[model samples]
Target: MNLSLEITGLTKSYADSGFMLDNVSLAIPSGTIMGFVGENGAGKTTTIKSILNTVQIDSGTIRLLGKEMTDRDTALREDIGVVLDSANFSAILTPGKLAKVMRGIYRQWDQELYVRLTDKFALPMNRKIKEFSRGMTMKLAIAAAMSHHPKLLILDEATSGLDPITREEILEVFLEFVEDEHHAILMSSHITSDLEKIADYITFIHQGKIILTAMKDELIYDYGVARCTSDQFRRIAEGDRLAYRVKEHQTDVLVKDRRGFGQQYSGIMVDQVSIDEILLLLVKGEN
Candidate 1:
């Protein structure tokens, strides 16, 4: 399989906070949607910035589509489409003017696709972006990003500001983009519900460390949250378990392998945990 991105031993640090990422390594195969999950300060955005060369890394290497990207190879950026929290647009320029500007910047810019997506997303072409609502700006950003038919997409909190309906719409656009199996996406968001639906793989980072990386479906099904009385909770052996919480008479345990435990603890009830729940449990500390 073609790899869209390969990052190895990635490390970054801030003043007095130690490394934002320590010995972090990840590979996103081409055409796969990789959901980057972390708490506010857990280096999700830091990793994205590092991949885009927007931030300087203390150590490690990142390769995009098998090409080693460096500060000198700015031209290589053409293959990447990035959408962050805000749109990279002159607030004064209308969407039509913005499209014209992009035409000069990207060699493969598709005015037809841009116009089609903008219309499909109902983005006002004549309105100044400054006057557009946050949702509209995001729609425009996505349209601009996809217009060039980039091979790789990097999104940081791109869906955080959207309503459910709009979020679903944007997700559909991502799905269609990767349908050709040559496009890939690296999406960083606290909104795991969106990731749960569309992401093919999940990478979780916490406290500057990679807690888990695996297939999204396996994450949901292989790991589970089991509930039992406080008395029953003492029955299971604990070592390398993911998470657990206590509430009065009941205890909930998040286990990595549910099949063996489920059969052993037939009296306990096991249920699938959402990405949000898994993140919450991880942030609270290793359980």
Candidate 2:
């Protein structure tokens, strides 16, 4: 498989907060979307910044489009389109002027594509970006990112401010982009529902450490949430559970196999788990 983005032993630390990305590693294959999930302060942005070389890394290797990341390689960067949580567009520039500015920077810039994307996103072409709402700014950023014909897109909370309809439209555009097989996306988002709808794989990070990475379908169909009393919980085999949390009256367990666990236990309820619930169980449960 061809990987568009690969990180090995990616580590970074901040002195102020003592927050560190501890030996983080993952890969996004071409033609697939990797959903990066975690709560606030879980090193999602830090990991991305380290990969982009915006912040200095203490140690690690980051490869983009199969080339090692280096400051001298502008060509490698041109192949990537990045949208962070906040876009820093010039306040006075309209969508028209922004297009002109980008054309000067990216050699592969497609003005026609930019125009079409702006129209599709319903962005005001003539209005100054400072006067636009947060959602409009985000849409403008996404338009700019896609218009350059990048091979890989790295999006950080890119859909936070948009309404449901707009989010759906933007997601459709993303799906269309990844259909090329030479294209891929690594999207870090709080919106797990969107990830559930679009992502091929899910990677969970907590407290600056990777908790798990697995296929989306495997997690949805094979993995399960097992509910049982304390006695039944103690009876559950250690090999079957990824993690388990005990409540006052019920013990919620994350089982590796839903149907298999049902057959093994006979009476304990083994239910399907969502991506969000998986994250919650993994983060809050004990191994």
Candidate 3:
């Protein structure tokens, strides 16, 4: 199927409050970059953890590179590179020593790529990890993840604190990684601007549920931000495809079926929405 990852009927929860994820399903095709978009506490990280088997699932199935995923026997994981917010390196070790430790852990680790990336990022090899700044630490994590040459890369907020130049450099690396037509990525981040530049698909989650998911191009082309007075909003929003809505003296609406909405609401102004605008309207709305 050329699909790199799949999740079906995935469910997870805390003790008594509510489900962190509920019957969620996701699929990422090989060579595609899928952006996992959500606000804080929106279950994006939980879903990623479930797929990686770091957390147990209540009832569901996960397949990575066409193999069923389980908590034990992480052989499939060896083919995947993961970067979280923190590097997970020993604070006392130097970058060179950390490289050796990771090489021992992954059977397919590429030492040449590791060395090249270290040089490319211009990381100081002898400095302790604890001494590195936040941006430098993020670069180190990227270097480690790319060193393994994995088929799939899963990142959770990997670019939260980097400067513009560093973020652009990382984006270039991601672009180069997908050039092979066999690699894929699932990146979770609140920084919508970064995702807009590189992601091919977008998924939005709010309040522990998936609000929308689709190709990035289609989202930009088809969905729209509609602003109107309160009376105009009421008259225009009474449709099946009104994906979501927010109300003030003026209102913003997200319509997935843009053609249908356009036909129905000829009086309202509908403009193309960016990833950030879509996220803002969805997360900030009153349900």
Candidate 4:
């Protein structure tokens, strides 16, 4: 498979907070949306910053579009579109002026596409960015990101403030972006429901460590959340167990192979799991 981004042993540490990205690694394939998820302060933003070369790492290598990322690689940087939690554009500039500024920055900036997207998103061109709502600012960031005709997109909390309908519309645009085999996206959001709807692969991090990386369907369907009594939990083999939590009446066990476990223990109940449920169980449950 052709990879759009690859990180190996990507590690970073903060002096005061003691937060560390401990040996993080993942691969994002072309034409796929990779949902980067974790709780706050779990290194999701740190990882993205490292990938963009904004944060210096202690040790590791990052490869984007088959080339190692370097601070001076303007060409490589241009191929990647990045949208952060908050855009840093001057509050006084209108979207129309921002477009002109962006045109000078990106070699491949498409003015026509920018106008179309702005219209599609229903953003006011004449209003200053500070006057725009949270949703409008986010939409404008997305419009700028897409207008660059980038091969890769990196979005951090891009969907957090938008209403469900707007989020759905933006997600459809993401789907269209990756319709071509050469395009890819790495998106990090607390909104797991949105990720569930659009992401092809899900990579989950917890406390600065990667816990799981798997296909969305496999994580959702093949993995099982088994509710069993303490006695029944003891019967589950160690190799099949991923994580488990004790509830008031029973134990919730996350099993690697739901089908195999179901077939092995005919009477046991193996329930389907959502991305959010799985994340909760992994982050809060016992191994």
1-287: candidate 1 lDDT, tens digit per residue? 88999999999988786656898899999889999999888888888888998888999989998887888886678889999887678899889999999999999899999999999999888999999988889889999999988999999999997899999999999999888787899999989999999999999999888888989998888888888787777887787266788867787788887786788888888888888888777777346
Model 2's alpha-carbon lDDT is 0.92
Task: List the candidates' TM-scores in order.
Answer: 0.95, 0.98, 0.93, 0.98
Over 4 Å off, model 1: 16-19
Candidate closest to the true structure, highest lDDT: 4
lDDT of 2 by residue, 131-236 (tens): 9988889889999998889999999999987889888988999999999999999999999999999999999999999999998889999999999999899898
- Report backbone clashes per prediction: 0, 0, 0, 0
Per-model RMSD to reference:
1.6, 0.9, 1.9, 0.8
lDDT scores in order: 0.88, 0.92, 0.85, 0.93
What lDDT would candidate 4 get against the real structure?
Answer: 0.93
Better of 2 and 3 by TM-score: 2
Model 3: colliding residue pairs: none
How much is the lDDT of residue 184 in candidate 2? 95
**Which regions of candidate 4 are displaced past 4 Å?**
none
Write the residue-wise lDDT of candidate 4 on 222-263 in tens digits.
Answer: 999999998889898887789999999999999978999999
Worst 10 residues of 2 by lDDT: 82-91
User: In model 4, what is the error at residue 21, expressed in angstroms?
Assistant: 0.3
Q: State the TM-score for model 4.
A: 0.98
